[model samples]
Target: MNTVMHRKPKPYRSERTTAHTSDRNASAFPSKRHARRYWILLSLFLFGGLLCSLGLLLYNNPVPVQSPSFWPVVERRITAVTTMAIAALCQSLATVAFHSVTNNRIITPSLLGFDALYSTIQTSMIFFFGAGALIGFSGTKAFLTQVGLMLVMSLLLYGWLLSGKYADLQLLLLVGIILGTGLNSLASFMRRMLDPSEFDILQARLFGSVTNADPAYFPIVIPVVLIVSVLLFLSANRLNVIALGKDVATSFGINHRRSVLYILILISLLMSMSTALIGPLTFFGFLVATLSYQVASTYDHKYVLPMAFSIGFLVLTSAYFFMYHIFNAPSVVSVIIELFGGLIFLTVLLRKRSL
Candidate 1:
């Protein structure tokens, strides 16, 4: 026996092995660097959008004085800009959060009957209490009540669905669709019974509109949005995990049930805020969320959330700017937005891509 000390089988360095190592290294670092670059690009886009909106807001002002004092004009412009920014931020954040919780980009918080409940609540108030009562309805108090009701309803629905043996997301969505239709029918019935003047009042609230937003409501809305955003940011990592499907998440020691519940409550609060602030936007969330995904090309919540918000801000701000300045009709923005958003929905559906 030639006692040749068997050298550990010469490490077989195959071409495949070398290629895999190279691929792994590239994946490990290049994507991260790419994400950073994408973030920078997004930041630049937001800055450019803001400057454009500001320019449009100041274009051809009717103030008696030519080029009024810079500070006062700047102050007013800032106020308008702030309002648009806050509203866009709140809506986008809420929509993205809603999509994440459901694990389906096609489904929005509004689709889960929150907006329907809002409509029913508002319509019922007008029908029973009459239009005059709307004047007495404290905006903050009403908003809180609506949010609370939405939370309860969402919890009940999600919990009930989870408790059942045959529960599935598709079933839940179907139930929501039916419930929403039912609520809309109820609202329409009530509207038909109202007097002509009352019908006019109800009609105004039926469709989505942002023009009626009152500055007084911002005090409450801003703080609520900020708090929710902070909570979302902290849980951003968990959201990314949750997106990998419930089974995988549970294996990773995540409490899937509890996490879903928390997400539902957060979505309800957000839906209530947006509905109260600017009425029901049936397709706006779908439009913005889908568009953001296309633009960002990543599912990381850290990137997706901010990108969605920025896109939402840009779209809404631009729409308002054009309607008020170029079109000389601020009231038409909502209609145009709805029309465009609907077309986007159809286009997306036709493409058959997983939303």
Candidate 2:
């Protein structure tokens, strides 16, 4: 004991302190370089989207720039671009938020039967009321009606399912799937009974395209979207926490169920608006959100949402522009987009091997 050298023990340091290093990186990005890369990528996507939109409005415009008809033609194109912006905003924001809340990157808002409900409504219109009713079942009034119907049903779903002791997301998803499958079967049966001419016309109406949108709904849609989008942006931080799963979110003092319910309501509104605005783009949101995760290279919704919107806008405008002017195949543009989106979906599934 006497021979023991009295050595002052090394001052205690936490693992955090001991491990601190200049090499440490952000959670989402591996290094500072990756953080910088995110901004650079964001800028590029934004610029590309704007360029495509301008090209859509002006490129191959047969009317001379100086002529009187030119402005009118451009004005018409403006409507299409506006529709693209709304659709992009809705899909991107909704999908990203939906992913965060659900804690699942693979499934999309379509899982909740919004798309199925939309399809059923359209098919039922043609089946019961005739194709003429389906044709006339447009304009601003009809648009609002469809949106209202979607929101109402979504509210009922959220309210009824998310309130009990047995409140469970998996349960809700299962119920939605069952409901969707039944509605889909009904719609399919109705479609089969229709005359070929009616079926053809109905088929044309069902395909999502810019031409399907009417500019008159813009005034109503713009205000609602702006309001909801603001709400979402304000909830970005909360979304980040929620994305980490319920247990983690609860430990962090968040009301996981309530937050999820509120967020789901917002998502429903977004999906409804997009579906009403331009029919159902089933995989468009998935495509946008997936590419955004790759391009954003971060878990931050604030940045991811913007990136998704930019990419979506770029995809839609560029696809329509190139298809119409270069390939003269505007009719198949939506088909092409869905095909690519489906292929990408399969690739992701195979790579992950689990949803």
Candidate 3:
């Protein structure tokens, strides 16, 4: 009567079994629903961008669709669209990559002084040679000159600030800021000395706009951008590791300095190309990166980069279409963008309460 009943033995899970079970729920997103959400957002951005692009091309067409002149009209608009795409690609990628390497979300690659350098170059051209010369400074040669100068300056900074025992990222940025301040001051002084008419001419070049981009430069600009863009996209994985900080990245067997240098060079090429082609879009990149982060809701650069690029394309296209077509205030489009971007930046800054 005192006999105990035997209980059924529980099955023991092996480590492999446990790991597999845990991994079954693991994904880029927290769950299946999140994965679905990300994809849906991405698709929406793409679709919206597509619609805006079409609107740019077809809205308010002066020529009839059947007319022989129709395609030419469309072709002319295509230049603007292409310029938007290139700017989006360059700014979005370069900003994201710069943020990753620096491990800071608040600062953009614009802090590296590309914009200042561009302003200085334009100002110098106008200051020394006159407005006529500045006007003549177009075509492939002028485009290449701007790009080459920016790259050379960036390379020199990297070499001087990142190679020695005292090499520090903060130091590099400090120097960049100082240089930018100096260049900006110099440019401002030169502007003050110019006649109103010449100042008027240079003012247009100073503003970041698609009209600043000449299609003639496309022959050289497109190939370089595509190549640098691919290289940056490929570096996305390494960026993810670098974003974890130097200690973590080193533990993962990554050459932290080398990776940082590589990324900086790529960023230089991207920013140089973008600033040269479109002038100083200072906050556009920050705007894209911030929005993309909110939309993507993840830190994976693979997703973040694409999401950034898509949002960038949509933002630029939509902004241009609305301002140029609907609002009929095309000149203020860049100003509008910068305003919103700065507002977003301040909001993010206040929320974080620290840089």
Question: Quick one: best lDDT, which candidate?
Answer: 3
C-alpha local distance difference test of each model:
0.74, 0.86, 0.91
Task: Decide which is better by TM-score, 1 or 2.
Answer: 2
Task: Write down the TM-score of every candidate.
Answer: 0.82, 0.90, 0.92
RMSD of each: 5.5, 4.3, 4.0
Residue-level lDDT of model 2, residues 227-334, one tens digit each, is 898899899889999999999999999999999999999899888998888888888998889878876777788878888888888888888888888899989989
Clashes of 2: 0
lDDT per residue as tens, model 3, 1-355: 2334334333666465777785675355766777788999999998999899999999999999999999999999999999999999999999999989998888889888999999999999999999989999988889889999999999999999999899788899989999998999999999999999999999999999998889988988899989988988888789989999989999999999999999999999999999999999988998899888777877788889899999999999999999999999999999998887678767866886644
Misplaced by over 4 Å in model 3 are: 1-26, 343-355
Model 2: residues >4 Å from true position, as ranges?
1-30, 343-355
In model 3, the worst 10-residue window by lDDT is 1-10
Q: List the residue pairs that clash in candidate 3.
A: none
Superposition error at 63 for model 3 (Å): 1.1
Which structure is stronger by lDDT: 1 or 2?
2
**Full ranking by lDDT:** 3, 2, 1
- Candidate 1 regions off by >4 Å? 1-37, 64-80, 163-171, 344-355
Per TM-score, the best of the predicted structures is 3
